[model samples]
Target chain A: MDILRIATSGSVDDGKSTLIGRLLYETGQVPTDRMQQIEESSKRRGLSFTDLSLLTDGLISEREQGITIDVAHIYFHTPARKYIIADTPGHEEYTRNMVTGASQSEVAITLIDARYGMLEQTRRHLHIAHLLKMSNLIVAINKMDLVGYERSAFEAIKSEVESYVNQLGASFTLHFIPMSALHGEGVTAFKDGLSWYQGAPLLDILESIKPRNIINAEGQTNFQVQQVLRPRGGDDPDFRGYAGSLRTGSIRVGDEIQVLSTGKSSTVVGVHKWGTELNASGPDQALTVLLADDIDLRRGDALIAKENDLATSRRMTASICWMDEQPMTSRKKYIYQQGSFSTKIMVDQIQGTVNLKNGELKSNHQVLLNEIAKATFKSASAIPAIEYQEGNSTGAFALIDEQSLNTVAVGFAERFA
Target chain B: MKISDFPRSLENEAIYIFRETLAQFERPVLLFSGGKDSITLVHLMLRAFHPLVPPIPLLHIDTGHNFPEALRFRDELVEKYQLTLHVRKVEDTIREKGLQEETGKYASRNALQAVTLLDAIEEFKFDACIGGARRDEEKARAKERIFSVRNDFGEWDSRRQRPEVFDILNGRIHPGENVRVFPISNWTELDVWNYIREEGIALPSLYFAHEREVFYRDGLIWPVSDFIRLSQDESPERKVVRFRTVGDMTCTAAVDSQAATIDLVMEEIAAAEISERGARIDDKRSEAAMELRKQNGYF
Candidate 1:
């Protein structure tokens, strides 16, 4: 099944969790007994209806505080598509979490309250989504019922968001949907009772969507070999293949691929899917590939298209979201772990923090926790960095703490102009 | 469509966690109980580092009253793949007076395994322990994180969990502290069966149909064993049955099944009307049995 990954962002009490829960419930992905528990809890709490937010807010503290503390992954499948919702906390301190969820997501649904359209938290979420290079965005103007479903209120919010979104450096296809998660107005497969609006339901919009075609500009495949399989006498002999998932582009039988760091060239002799043999392999196909020519490639090495060098550069300028409690310091030594490869790197510069609202770049020396900033920094040595704008695996990375060995921040290497 | 072609977000997340554990921790072990969920976890661990040796080892905490097939399957997998297999026996723990064997018809040593597990962790100094716990199995598990922290005494502090965001798992454990990692915490029981069938992974024969000395107790098929002592009112008998959950034999119940092959077992699982953990008598011991077990580091 084609996966539709959506990252949801909004402040607490904006009904982000409720919207996600309603989407899953309307799609019939929730188990029956689990639903019964929620029903009973609602009754105990003396509520007239079940609280859908309880589904995604899974942590013990979150339930106790009635807020999401971290990014909890919630999965629900419909007949048309399987959805993975990386539900992030809406608090200002959790901006790192909002960025973390947005890093892997293809589409971002930024929720704004119709009663309080485009608050500080709303701008922060939208800014984080844009900075993460999320291609598709939906500006969900939520809680129309609270404001008597006023059309003017919805329109005012829509234009205000569009005017801000149009100026974003990271361009995203945008849409606006006005709905009330409390009353189940337009968030699911339900027909719009308010005929003031004309459009597909949220489910239809989410299901019919195909992730934007990822065309690696230079027509290349960055097949970094993770492991080399050499069976001495098991089954077949002379069977040597560099095994790693295709991280960037596609490779077919006749395509000429290059083994980076070695300058060796070979035709794609075969593509081995995890257990099954295949004719071609593309991005995210965690498979083994056999090249006609035997070349030395280990973990952290890239197999680029013979002529395509788009993702092979070593220097990177990136927008980073600091997640650790420790503030970002310049030239601090840390490990740069991208995919299966880990190498030592030092942060050379702390460029500037993002203003978020007006896309204004504020010059700064460093960033603190939950802060987003764009920096131009050189690797301690040299490492491969494609623009995080293209490849999912290569373009992104996390800075490993030198002392604690914990990953502190998720970063997107800025695309070379 | 090839299962490999399509990826479940939960499965990808689990694989990522498994790899991260291998890369980050010094000594990690996967707690295998010979159940379908753990079996699926084994397969995922294998694929996570395919072409290379599996990074970590597999540990089985034998309750001694396990089905013969489960024991045999554990050995076969070790011998077949040349995997690092470590077996810790509860029988030894009982003989050494580390745990007391329960008495009476309703008596079970399911809770006592925690003591033996803590002993093993202390012996090995394992930093991270991975298991096949799923959220849908129980309420507390649904409340767990991918990387759950444990104290020096191997106790889960429910009040204090480091926030997990994106793929960044906080495997931070202070000295003498260990982390309990559940890679498949998001998968449902059906996902495990589907993955096993899809991958054609080997499983214990006890999961399939077989003749076993069993008796009915409290609407469950209780395996007849010296440890699984039966009531005077009931008689030991042989019946065609299979274990749905390969927990401790005293608490683990058998379900009536004729399906033997992986495909048939999956079909049966899909059509079955009961939860996989429903057959576990230990869980039925209390509303929060699993939660308390987790707090005590029962992984």
Candidate 2:
């Protein structure tokens, strides 16, 4: 079964948790005992309806506050597919937390209230998802039951979002569905509240989609070694292997490859995986690769294609979504890590910040909490900054505070000649 | 190529994490125990750097109450792969009487392993210790990040944690701090077993079905030879059983099943409604058991 990683984001009262609970419960993915536990807990609280957020928000404080303070992983497998939901917070302050959840997700399900068409936070989440290059933008306009199950209410919100997303100019494929996460309407069942509507249920739509291939970089190939193992006592005493999982593209035996850092040349002796030797290598497999010679390659080094696809430049400019509570300025030195390679990068300049409500760039001198800004960095050493949209491992990097050693922001490297 | 050549997403994700620790941390170590999860971690790590001898060291906190099979497997794998193995025994502390052995039915030195683990970390000065802890196993674990940082005293401050965005892991630790990386945090028990079976991964034999000396207690099977005293209510019974999880034998309970093969094992997990940790009697000790343990340096 294909995997669909979906992030749930909405306004505080939009019932984001209920939508996830409805998805899990309606699909019968939850076990009988867990459902009983939910039922019993709701009874203890003297509530008319069972609280679904308890299924995702596992913290004691989160359960007591009746709000999700952190992102939690909730899984449910259907016969046709498997689903992993990143139940992110809907509160305004936890926008950073929502990005943490949405960053790993391929699809973003933005929960909106029918009573309130589009809130500021909704736009912020869509902007984050789009900026992060999440292709599937699903506006799950929830709580249709409260609005007399009106078709016009859903249509108005959908059109408004469509116009805004167009202006955002972040490549996105979108879907708009009216849903009642609390009542399990339009989410998992066929609803005729709007006779003009003809679309698959939320579950149906989820199952129809294929798993987003991890090999997003079609032509680009970037390989980073984890470790080199020389089996000293093995039959081939000179057997040298640069072992790591291939995240993108492919490497085959007899292909000419260049080892990074040292700038040495070697041929792929073998591409081994699945506890056996393979003639070829594919993306994201735990494979041991044998090189023709005894190369001085270790972890943190890379094996690049001969076609010239990499660089060891000590400087880069990228867009960063600052997460720390304190204002982060370009003058500060932070530890920037991309893939296995990392360096001490001093923020040289903050060029611009995008307006959250309107997707326009605001002139900025610094980045504050939850602010996305373009910044140029001068590094203490050479750092890897691959395109975020091209290669996930090589493209995405984190900026860490040297004093606290806390990862304050994640950035995508934007390069120009 | 085999039809199973396509790797499971979670397993590949974990291998990628192992590579990160290798690529990033200066002094990294595999926090190995005799559990299936950690064993799977070792296997994945091996696959991560196969053909080449694994460079990272292996750190094991021996509670001294482990099943003999785990000890045997641990030794063989270490030797076979020529690993830089380091074992810190609780018995060494036991000789010093650092912890007095319990005498009653609830007698278990499982909690005392934390001291030895802390001692080992201080001795090795390991910057990153990788383990096989999954979120779905427990509620406290559910809130855990892929890279969990520990203070000089080996305390987990769950209240304050770094927000891990995308695949970007924050492995930067202060002079006295070490990060505990959980590569398989998102994987389920079924996922692990499926990957093991797919790769034909080597595991300790105790996980497979076998006739063993066991006892019935609180509607569960407790390995009689496990390192704990039994209550009078519990009686011995020689039954065919298998282990879902392996920890301190005293606290690790076995289940009655005939899943002698990996295929049957997958079938068992598919059919079994309860979680793998549900069989771990130690975790069931209290409602806040895992959280309390984590706070006190249980990785």
Candidate 3:
């Protein structure tokens, strides 16, 4: 069964959690005991009906405050596929959290309150989806019941969202679903509402939408060695395999590959996966490979096809989403990590920051938390990397704080400078 | 090449997490409980660092209420993989801390293992501890990050967690602060059973149907073991049963079943309505039991 990773993005009161809860309840995925638990909690909180929001609000602070503060991983299964919904916060300050959800998701559901057609927070979400390269967009016109289930109301909201997305020039499989998450109409099962609206229910669309297989880069073969495996004792003294997951493309025995960082080339002699030898392996396969010749390779090294033109760079420009409370300053040193490799790098210059609310780019000298900025960075040592548009895993990097070691920012390589 | 050349998704993900732990942490250890989930973790660890013995050691917190078969399985795996095994006992910790173990009807050592584990972490100064926890197992775990950071006191502050985006795991932490890594967080209970069946991994005998001395308690089957103090009304009876999850024998209940093979076990799980954690008596204390335990340093 395929796993469909989805991210739900919308402003507060847009009913992301309620829709997810209805999805779970309608699909019979919510067990009886769990439902009883939710009911009791809802009653304690003086809710008139069973508050679905209480289901996804797992943290104590979230329940006490009655708002989702972080990303909650909600899982449900249909006959066709399994779904992992990364329900993200809708507040503007939680843009980093929204990016966190969008980064791993193939589809993004940007909800629109029927009363409020489209808001700045909605545009902010769509912009991040574009930045993260989300392939699918579901513009769910929620709370149709509040508007008397009028067809004109749904159409207006849908076209408003379509124009906004088109204005942003994002190419995603656009879907529009009109539903009331609270009343459970047109969500998992269609109920008596909006007879003029003719589209598959939100749950059906979610199940039918095939998650784009993107474990690796598109149209490119890239492999990063995560670890070096050498026989410890005489049991397999001759075995020296490069253990790593294929970021993209495929590799087979006898395939000549280049060590990108070192410029050394070697032939694949064997491909082993969990005691089973395979003739070939492709993206996301965590396998071990033996080379025909002995070469020095360590973790964070890249192994690509001999013909590919991946650059070895000491300086590069990338679009970074700042995550830490501390502002990013020029000439400040941090650990730049891509794939499994980490190198000391200094911020050269802050090009500009994106005004997330309006999608405007402003020349800025400092990058603050939850802001997206294009910045040039200079590394102390040369490293192999690619542009984010070229390949996500190969091109994306994270800045690690020297003191806290917390991931301060997420960056996508734009060019080798 | 066919897409079949790609490794299974969940297994591949677990391997990826294992590799990340090895790359990021200086002193990392795998928390093994001799349960199927931990067993699966060990298997993935081997694959993650194939052609060589896994560099990390195995840490087992013995609650002293474990089944004999589970201990035997743990020993065999440690020897087979040539892994360094670290065993911390709750009984020892209770004696040293002058802590009182629960008694009477709800007596159990399940929660006490958390103190033992915290002590072990402090003693060894391990920066990362890999666990086999899955989100589908419980609700609180559903909100856990893949690289969950614990403070110096090993407390999990859910509201104050680092935002993890994409495949990039933030393993950064200050000294004395440790990270609890859950590689199989996305996997469901059925996913685990399916993987075990596909891989043909060995499990403890308790997972299979066998005749055991058991007693009825709260509509669940309780095993007659050393740690359990049976009441006069609760007499031990022979029953054919198997364990869905292996934990402290005093707290982990058994389910009535004759399914001895992996295929039958899969069938039972598919048709079963109750969750795997439902059989865990410790979780019956309250609605927020797991969350409270997690806040206080329980894996």
Candidate 4:
């Protein structure tokens, strides 16, 4: 069975945890003893109904504060596929945590309380998902039981979200499901409500959706060299392989490739995936390629197709999400970790922060915590960068503070400035 | 349309993590415990650097109360692979520090291994220590990142952890600070068993069912050990059992099962109700036992 990773974002009381618990309960994934424990905790809390959120709020701080502060990964499986849900916090201060959850996910689900309609938090999540290129979205309109299962209420929120999507110019395969997570309605199947709605249930939609396609499906092979392996004289002594995962496209034994950083050339002598020697290697596979020539290669160097030399420059403009408590300003030095390469970088300019409520790029010099902005930077080394629109893995990078050594920001390349 | 269209397998993901660790850290060591998960890691390490021994060394913190079978298996693998093995003893540290061992039925040296682990880290100056900790084992581990950073004092600060985005891991740290990398953090117990069967990896004899001297406690089978202080009424009984996890004899628990082969073990794991760590007596100490131990540099 294939694996589908989903990122879930919802505020504290949006019944996000309840929705997940209901999913687990419906699929019979929660064991009997665990369910009994939840029941006992619910009774201790003096709730007439079981508090399903108790399952997801695992941390003591979260249980004490009654709010999720970080992301928790929950796993479940069906006959057709396995699923991993990256449950992220909804508070604004924890926006960085949400980004972490969404980074590796192919689909994003945003939960909306039926009464609140569309809040700023909803827009913020949608914007981040779009920025991350999440292909499919499920705007779950929850708490339909409280709204009398009215079809108009669900339609009202759907239209409002559609308008925001249009303004942002984000093209996502959007699906809206109206249900009560507490009652397990419209999650896997609908019952006794929303006769006006004619669509598959949430689980059906999830199973039917295909894995997100890479943007440049036909892009050339771009392999980043992670480590160099040399076996000291033993059984098979003449083995030297460059180990890394293929970010895009494929490579064969005789394919000629060029180093992106050093501009050297070599022919692939061997393509090894773990132990076996494969004729070719595909995307996302960890492979070790033996080269025909002994070239000067180091970590963070890339081996690209001979015909495809990525744009290399020392300066680039990018959309940055500031995650540190210290505000980011021009002329500050930080370490830029791009793929396996790390280089010292200085912020050349801070254009502005992007406002999610309205699709506007406001002009600002300072980017504070939990703020998304456009910025330009100059790296000490000539790094190979591709525009994020081209679906390049090297386009994404993280900035670590010089003094604290904390990753302060995540950025995606926009253009060569 | 084809098998190639599917997402990456858990093996590929783990291999990716291993390569990343080798690329990012200067001095990295693999923490081997002779358990299935860590043994699986050893197998992957071989494939990851095929035809060659991995540059990384294996570090084992011996608690002086380990199952004899586990120690034998560890030595056999070390000799077969011709790999470097470093052993640190908790008993030496216990004697040097003059610490008192618990004198009850549930006395364990599991928690005391933290002191020895931190001391080894300081001695080796290892920038990264890779382990086989999976999130599905315990609640505290559910929130751990693939690359967990530790402070200079070897403490875990889960509250302010760095946000790891996509496949890019930030291994930058201060001089004394080291990172703990969990390559199989997303894998489940069933997945581990399936991989073990698929890869045909060999494990310790304790993993298979055998007749052994054991006693019952808290609905779990405890192996007879000198470290454990049994009550007056408790007596050892022979039962056909196999260990689900391997740790110190005082803390690890066994379960009654006739499933000896890898296939049967996989089936048993699929039908099991509780988590693999449910039988661990150390985690049963308190609500935040794992968290407290992790904060004090326990792997």
Candidate 5:
């Protein structure tokens, strides 16, 4: 079975954890010991019912504060697919954590409390998800029982989210499900309460949804060399292979590829995975390619299809999400890393910070923690990059503080010059 | 789809991580525990650099209170792969460093493995320690980054962890500081078992059911061994049991099962209600037991 990675985001008390716990419990993924632990903890806390939120609040501080502070990955599997839920924090201060969770996920599940309509934090969550280019947007209007399971309340919130998503110009598949995770209504199997609603339950929607093939859009092959394997005494002596993961598109044997750094061309003689040779390999598979002519290829070098060309420039405009506590300023050099390549870069200008309230970029010179901004960067060396919309894997980069060595910001390439 | 047609995405991710670690770190070592997860790591590493054995070595911090079968398997694996193996004994660390060993029933050297591991890291100057930790195993591990960085003292600061975005990992660190890389952080226990079954990877015999003298305690079955100090109220009983996770004999618990093969073990895991770590005695100490241990440099 294939794996589906889902990121859950929303405002605090939106029951993101509870919804996840309900999903796990309904699917029989919650082990007996964990269920008992939750049971005992609920009783100790003087609650008559089991608190499913206790399952995802793994940290002691989170349990004490009754809030999620970081991203916690929860895993479960059905016969159809293995699901990985990145339960992200909802607080505005932890927006970076939400981005961290949604960055690797293909689907984004935005939870909305039925009692309260779309809050500012909810909009922020949706904005970040859209910025990350999530293929599927699952809007789960939870706590329907709190609102008396009224179809009007669900419709109100559904229309609000739809209008806002339209303003954001989202390109993903939007799905709205009304459910009460606490009471287990409309989660796995729809109960009798929602007679007005006629739709598949949340679990069914997840299982049936296919993760969009973002890589095969243009059939543009972008492979970065991570390592070079050479065995002198092996059966085939004088063997040299360039090993890396195919970030985008597919590669086949006898395909002509261009080395990004040197601009040299070579024919792919062999495509090997593990110890066996494959006739062809698709995106995301880690394989080694044997070039017909042994040209100079090292780590951080890219192998692109001869027909495709990546933007190579020392200046780049990107969308930056600041993650560190220290505010970012201009002319501060940071280590900009994309794939295996690393180079020193400085933020030349902070164009504007994104207005989460309206999904618009606002003029701002300084970026504080958890703030998203559009900025231009000047790298010490020319770098190969692509638009983030075109290639998520190859277009994204991280900026690490030179002194602290902490990842301070994550950027997506928009244009290169 | 048949089991053979299962998606190899997880394997691809793991191999990608292995290659990244090899390229980034100068002196990297795989923390081999003779468990299924670490065994799977070795297999992935071998596959990652095909036609060439992974240059990284294996480090096994031997807690003396280990299952004999696991040790035997470890030796056989090292020999089979012709890989370099480093064994640092907690027993030796305790003797040399004058570290106090816990006493009484449930007293285990599991916590003491941290000191030996730090000492080994310092000795070899290993910049990166590749582990088999998965997020689904426990709560604290769920929040851990794929490239978890440790201080010069090997302390894990969960609160100030660097943000890991997308597939790009930042492995940059300072001198005397090391990073603990977990390649299979996304994989669940069942995923590991499925991969093992698909790949037909060999594991220690302890994973399979065998007749052993065990005693029931605190709703768990403890093996009757010299390392464990059993109380007088508890008596040893012979039963067919298999271990879900292999750790120190004093900490790892056994479950009653007749799964003697990989397929049977997978079926048993799928049907079993208790989690893989549920049988572990150390984690039962408290809710933040793993977190506390991890902060002190425990793997």
Candidate 6:
């Protein structure tokens, strides 16, 4: 079975953890011991019923404060597919954590409290989901039990969100479900509530959505060299192979390829996966490619189909989400790492920061913690890259503070400047 | 075109991580515990550097309370692969440093293994310790990153964790500090079993069901071993049982089953009610037992 990655986002008290806990429970993923642990934890808190949220709130500080602090990955499975859910914190200050979780997810489940309607955090999550180009957005209107499961309460919030999303011109397939995660209503199946709802339950909607594979997209072959495998002491003596995963498109034996860094051309003599040879290989498979000609190719070098053109530049404009408490300013130097490539880069300019409430780019000189902004960067050396919309592997990069060595910002390349 | 297979995808991800660790770190070692998870890591590492054996050595922090079956299996594996094996015993650390050992029933050397591990790290100056930790196994592990950094004292500061994006991992660290690399952090318990069955990877005989002297305790089965101090009232009974996870004899509990093969084990796990870690007695000490151990450099 294939894996389906999902990210959950909701403000405090919206019951994100409860929804996840209910999903795990309904799927029979929660074991008896864990169930007992949560039951006892709930009892220790003096609660009459089991508080399922204790399962996802794993951190000590989180349990003490009764709020999620960071992203926790929850794994479960059904007969059809394996599920990986990133339970991201919904607090305003943890937007960077949300981005980090949502970056690898195929679907975004945005939780909305029925009583409070649409809040700023809800809009912010939706905005980030859109920015990440997520196509499936499941808007779970949670806590319907408090609103009496009224169709009117659901419709009012639905219309408001519908108009706002339309204004943003998002292309996500929105699936709205009204239910109470605490009571296990309308989660896995509709039971004793929400008779007015016509859509499938939350679990069904999740199962129906197909995980997009960028590997199959029609694009140029891009393989970033992760390591050069040279088993000089084995059965065969002179063996040199460029080892890496195919980031985009496909590659076959006898295919002519060009090295992006050295501009050297070579023919693919063999494709090897763990010493076994294959005629051809598809994307996302970690394999080694042996070249007919001996060319100097090292890590941080890219091998592409000779005919395809990948942009190689020293300057590029990217939209970045600042994750560090120290604000990002122009002319500050950091390490820009894309795929296996790493280079020293200077933030040339801070163009503007995106206003989450509205889809507007506000002019800003500095990007504070958890804020999203567009900026231009000048790398010390030219490197191959693609537009973030084109592919994920070559288009994304992490900015690291040279002094602290902490990942300060995650940026998506918009275009080469 | 060959579509990506589920297990193969996970395998490729793990292989990528293994190669990346080798490329990034100056000195790296695989933390092997002779458990199914670390055994799977060894299998993947073998495939990662096929013609040539994995250049890194294997480090095993022996608690001296381990099962004979696990220790025997560990030695045979090292011999078969011609692997460089480093065994540092907690028994040695306790005697050499005059460390206090826990007394009474339920006292375990599981926690003491961390001290031996940290001492080993310092002795060998290993920059990266690749482990077989999976996020699905525990709640605290769920919040940890693939490249988790630790201080000079081997303390894990969860609050100061660096954000990991996409498949990119940052292995950069300061001197005297090391990163704990988990290549199989994404694999679930079932996923490991499924892959093990698919690949036909050899495991210890303890994984399969056999008649063993065990007794009931805390609604769970406990094996009769020399290391564990059984209560006066407790009596050993011969029953067909198997271990889901292989830890020290004092902490790792057994399960009553008749599954004598890998297929049966997988089927039993799929139908089992309790989680894999449920059999681990160390985690049952307190709600934050695993977290506390992890913060203090427990692997």
Return the top candidate by DockQ.
Answer: 5
> Which docking band does candidate 3 fall into?
medium
Poorly placed runs, candidate 1 (over 4 Å): A189-196, A211-219, A228-241, A252-256, A262-277, A289-296, A311-314, A415-417, B1-28, B45-56, B91-115, B125-130, B134-188, B205-244, B250-292
lDDT of 5: 0.88
Docking class of 1: acceptable
Q: Per-residue lDDT tens digits of candidate 1, residues B51-126? A: 5566679988888877777888888887877789888987888888755678766777676778778888888989
Query: For model 6, how does the per-residue alpha-carbon lDDT over A1-417 read when each residue is reduced to its tens digit?
Result: 677889999998899999999999988888888999999999999999999999899989889999988889999887777889999999988877788898878699999999999998998888777767786999999999998999899999999889889977877899889989998988987778776677899999988987666334446788778898887576787888888878767788889999987678999998888878885444567888899998988887889988877668999999888899999999999999986889999999999998877778899999999888899999998868677762255688899998888888888888896
Please list the Cα RMSD from the true structure of every candidate, rounded to 1 decimal place.
Answer: 4.4, 3.4, 2.8, 2.6, 1.9, 2.2
**Can you give the DockQ of every candidate in the order shown?**
0.25, 0.44, 0.51, 0.53, 0.75, 0.62
* Candidate 6 interface RMSD, angstroms, 1 decimal: 1.9
Which fraction of the native contacts appears in each prediction? 0.09, 0.51, 0.51, 0.57, 0.82, 0.60
Q: What does candidate 4's lDDT look like per residue over A1-417, in tens digits?
A: 577889999765787778888887898777655677678878977899988777777787877777778888888877777788888888888988988888878788899999899988898888887777677889999999899999999999999999999898786789999988898888898887765679877889889877543344446688888888887887667777898877778888889999998779999988887667786544467888899998998887889999885768999899888899999999899999877778899999898899878968998889999888898899999878677642345678889999998889888888885
Q: What is the number of residue pairs that collide in model 6?
A: 0
Residue B1, candidate 1: Cα error in Å is: 17
The per-residue C-alpha lDDT of model 4 at residue B228 equals 81
| Tens digits of lDDT, candidate 3, A1-417 | 678889999998789889889888888777766777789998988888999777787777667777677788887777667788888888777777777777778889988999988898888788777777777888888999999999989988888778777777777779998989999987876678765667898887887776666433255666778887777685888778888878777787888999988889999888788667786445567878789989988888888888998788898998888988999999899998876788899999998998755566799889998788888999987877577752245678889889878888888887896
By the TM-score metric, which is better: model 1 or model 3? 3
RMSD of 4: 2.6
How many collisions per candidate?
1, 4, 0, 0, 0, 0
Give lDDT tens digits, candidate 2, residues A1-417: 456788889888788888887887787656655676678778888989987755676666676778776777777777655677888888877777788888888888898999999998888888888778886878898888889888889899999999899988868678888888787787877555644568767887777666566435354455777666666676667666676767666788887888656679888878877447665434555667778877787666777776655666667788888888987886899887765666788988888898877888888887889888888888886654466672254677788898888989988878722
- Pitting candidate 1 against candidate 2, the one with the higher lDDT is 2
Sort by DockQ, best first.
5, 6, 4, 3, 2, 1
* Model 3's TM-score against the true structure: 0.95
lDDT of 1 at A83: 66
Clashing residue pairs for model 5: none
lDDT (Cα atoms) of all candidates against the true structure: 0.73, 0.78, 0.83, 0.84, 0.88, 0.87
